[model samples]
Target: MSELKEQLKSQIIEQLNLEDLTPADIKNDSPLFGDEGLGLDSIDALEFIVLLDSFYGIKIEDPAAAREIFHSVDSMADFIESKK
Candidate 1:
């Protein structure tokens, strides 16, 4: 689980092109899509959807659903683990 979180953080930083952040900078439970956290926007959300499909082979077709499931690193890990 810890390894998965670390991997997810690395992937998120890379896929989202977050040049300012390292994996250690992102808390597991931190909100990932708002001004308060990483300040990611809709495009980043889409990129995350792509990341899920490409990296985890989890297909998420709905943006609204993706928003809820990919709310944070912990939530994303939970969703991926559930799928697995």
Candidate 2:
């Protein structure tokens, strides 16, 4: 689980081109979107969807559903775990 979290963190930073953030900077339960969190927008959300499919082989077609599941790193991990 820790390995997955670390890999996800690194992937997120790399995929999103967040040059300023290290994996240690992100909390496991931190919100990934909105002003209260990473400030990610709709584009980031789309990227996350792509990330899911590309990295995890999880295909999420509905934008609304994706929004709910991809709300935070923890949530995304949970979703991925459920899928597995």
Candidate 3:
């Protein structure tokens, strides 16, 4: 699970082109949206959907579900593992 979390962090930075942030800079439980954590916006959310599909082959069918699933790296990793 930890390994998956690390992979998620890397994926996030890579897929989102977050060149300013390193994998270690992002907390596993940190919010991925808003000004609270990564300061990500809705555009990043759309990219996240692409990231899920491209990397894990997991397509998020419902846009609403992305709000909860992409809330944090931990949650995203859990979602990926469950889909597997």
Clashes of each: 0, 0, 0
List TM-score per model, in order: 0.95, 0.93, 0.94
Q: Highest TM-score among the candidates is held by which one? A: 1
lDDT of 2 by residue, 1-84 (tens): 778888898999989999899999888888888897788989998889888899999998887778878787788888899999
Give the least accurate 10-residue stretch of model 2, judged by summed lDDT: 63-72
28-79 per-residue lDDT for model 1 (tens digits) = 9989888978998898989998999999999888887788887899999999
The Cα local distance difference test for each model comes to 0.91, 0.88, 0.91
Query: Could you give candidate 3's per-residue lDDT for residues 1-84 as a string of tens digits?
Result: 999999989999999998888899999998989999999888899999999999999888777668999999999988998988
Clashes of 3: 0
User: Which window of 10 residues has the lowest lDDT sum in candidate 1?
Assistant: 61-70
Question: Which pairs clash in model 3?
Answer: none
Candidates 2 and 3, the one with greater lDDT: 3
lDDT of 1 at 46: 91
How much is the lDDT of residue 30 in candidate 3?
89
Residue 7 accuracy (lDDT) in model 3: 90
